[model samples]
Target: MRLAHAHSVQQSGAYVRKFGAAALLLALCSSVGVIATSGTPATAAGDATSASRARTDELTLRTGQTLAKVKASIPSGSYAGAYVDPSSGTLRVLVTQQAKAPALDTRADAPLELVKARYSLAYLEQRMGEVFAAREKLNGKNSRIVSVDVDEAANSLQVAVDGPIDAALRGRITRLAPDTPLELVQGNSFAPQRYAGSRVDDFAPWSAGVFIYNKTTGGGCSSGPGVHVGSTKYMVTAAHCATATGQQFYQGHQDVPSVTPELVGTVANRSGYPNLDAMLVNGNTANTVYRSWYNFYTASSAPWESLTGQTVCTGGAYSGERCGLVIGQTNVCSDSLRSCGLTIATGPVNTVAAGEGDSGGPVYITAPGLRYSGIVTGPVNPANSITCLNYPSGLRSCSNAIVFTRIQNILAYFGASLN
Candidate 1:
């Protein structure tokens, strides 16, 4: 189950629901052959426009390869920080202990720069864990936290509390990790959404934008990318979209009129928070697939191994297709303080990306030919409200933001493959 997704969705009437996602198709790049070659400094800044564009292009092409090689070669706890900086058209690396950072010989041939940070990456992650634990103490009314964002840019672990942070709670967070940056903001928490699926006997076209269902619970959700484990077909979706596995899988919705859907697959498996919120719908020859994949989302196609400043576009039934930028990563936890998981952060896209019943849609990059990426995870509200940004909007852009799960982790977890 190579994870590829896009979209923002909420399952109506469900308590522990899953986040929506994008379903991007994996398209290979021709220049992939040179991903290993170190980038030459851009020519004298003539085409401030052309020169900048060239740098960005180079950054996108090499970020993934460079990051992968860095992650693979670095020691456990040595990976201080790494990000794709669109502004500089370079990959930046932050080291807590400069002497312990990876040797230049280990870096791939990408446009990269290195710096030093006050804290080690591992320590910050550990502090974030403590902050999540502290958030569990807050009652939903006074200081409920919706999400915890990892802001490497600010070198802080941001906590998005649903409301204002009281004095006592503030002190606790401050005391937990005195040196750690634990910033808080306000926003409404998520709720369940309606408009999703059920199974049918006839053979209906199982394409993107259709509904999906879990037979046991009879709940409805949208379909994402049409994938296959070898020749076996599957519908990649959020694990929470369905309640139980080993049950029958259906399409479209019996509640929504105007048409019918087919019995395309079965609830093969699922995993909730703490792990990736995704599942595989095992379909067979009986399933009819149409334009079941991404449309012209990117200029071409690419993989999901890069991040930070990279762009992520998504598609859903209600919102259609749209593109957004990769901002950062986010972590979400439940009341019991158990179901904790991290997701790829994006959005406030300039297009309608996700909508009601659009869970498990599709997401990719649009410029380099709809390069496939990962699935939609959830939404986040910036720690600040002065800026009316972060809402999914039109091509002109508006306030919006989105979160998704990386396909690299998805494929590695499910042991699946894609082009």
Candidate 2:
């Protein structure tokens, strides 16, 4: 309905906020953690611990460090939290801080069981590399995963995972390697685009256009204010926008057919094909031609390592204009598109943040004019759920986060440099 701040009381609740009784039911279901249980003694024994225990186990950290040593070292201020990965059978130790400390406690009465298990140095090294690689592949870029050595002597793990590695994975790694030195690599081929500004109603000095393609009816469907990448025109819309077989591009301000509509480019390389529902549109000359009329700014080539708290803006046919702060970025892989994620924000934007016809509008950071940020791909509405096959009967699920095609990746795909 209306595009409002994510923190607003109306919007700031859990996923079930809009569902009412259904939400309460879902919460109950989650708390119970059991769907069906057989009436057998073994089943009853299994039920001794609720299914939520299993879920909690999944998130819990078990360490492999000896109990005596862990207990003896507990008061050293070096220990934090510990857990074990059931899937990998590795112990993970979360360090609270980095400081000099005595050796781990190896007393027989130490509470090692309570501390959870930890992985061997070698295992952690390999696992860190695997995480690094996974993030790189997902981000469609490269990065390094620095290994941390956990020593009983120091009571800390010196970890390093950072740089211009990949946007999708950066946040995760940062969370996993908290307080560690993460060097973000920059100046690489894949960099994130900054938000410019949006097109207000009948706004002057800002070129406004729509992204369109032919539908089955011999007519056309359109979405607009395609973002400009460089001298070449490009629009960021949903992959579904150009999914029609005979798709064509249209450039205009409103839904009305242009008096002399020019043919812009159609979607070429689309990510989040199935799940994310995003696409990249290569504009025709008509697209770039319209940009001249408005004081449109070109995309930036600079790589944005992170956007938390950074002021941003968006310009679209629907949500005329809005501004806010970058909250976070996440990597989301759906059946349609893999290795894709989006950067999210909360702010005072247009009334209707986005609508059906606003799929390809640009999301930018505006100072006075506009610095190209990203293209609006999808809405983060709670009503929209991702169709994922997690249930036995095949079901879809919903999440609070929205998805977008990273602008930096789009510009690189077209071989266009952001200003």
Which candidate achieves the best lDDT against the true structure? Answer: 1
If scored against the real structure, what TM-score would every candidate get?
0.45, 0.40
Best by TM-score: 1
lDDT at residue 50 of model 2 (Cα atoms) = 43
For model 1, residues 247-353, the per-residue Cα lDDT tens digits are 77676555445555457677785643224555777764211111222321111112434456666666544345555556453222211111123234455544344
Mind giving the per-residue lDDT tens digits that candidate 2 earns over 1-419? Answer: 11111111222332112111121101112221221211111011222134333322222111222322453654444354443334453434444443223354333111223332233334444444545455444343444433222332233333333344556555766666554434443422222222342222222222433324332112222243344454555544544444332355444322333233455555554433423334445653222111222333333233232245665554544333445545554222221122133445544332333433334455654322234555555444435433332111222232223334455444433344443
Per-candidate count of clashing residue pairs (backbone under 3 Å): 42, 47
Model 2 segments more than 4 A misplaced: 1-235, 244-246, 253-258, 275-282, 285-295, 298-306, 332-339, 348-351, 367-369, 384-403, 412-416
Error of 2 at 326 (Å): 4.2
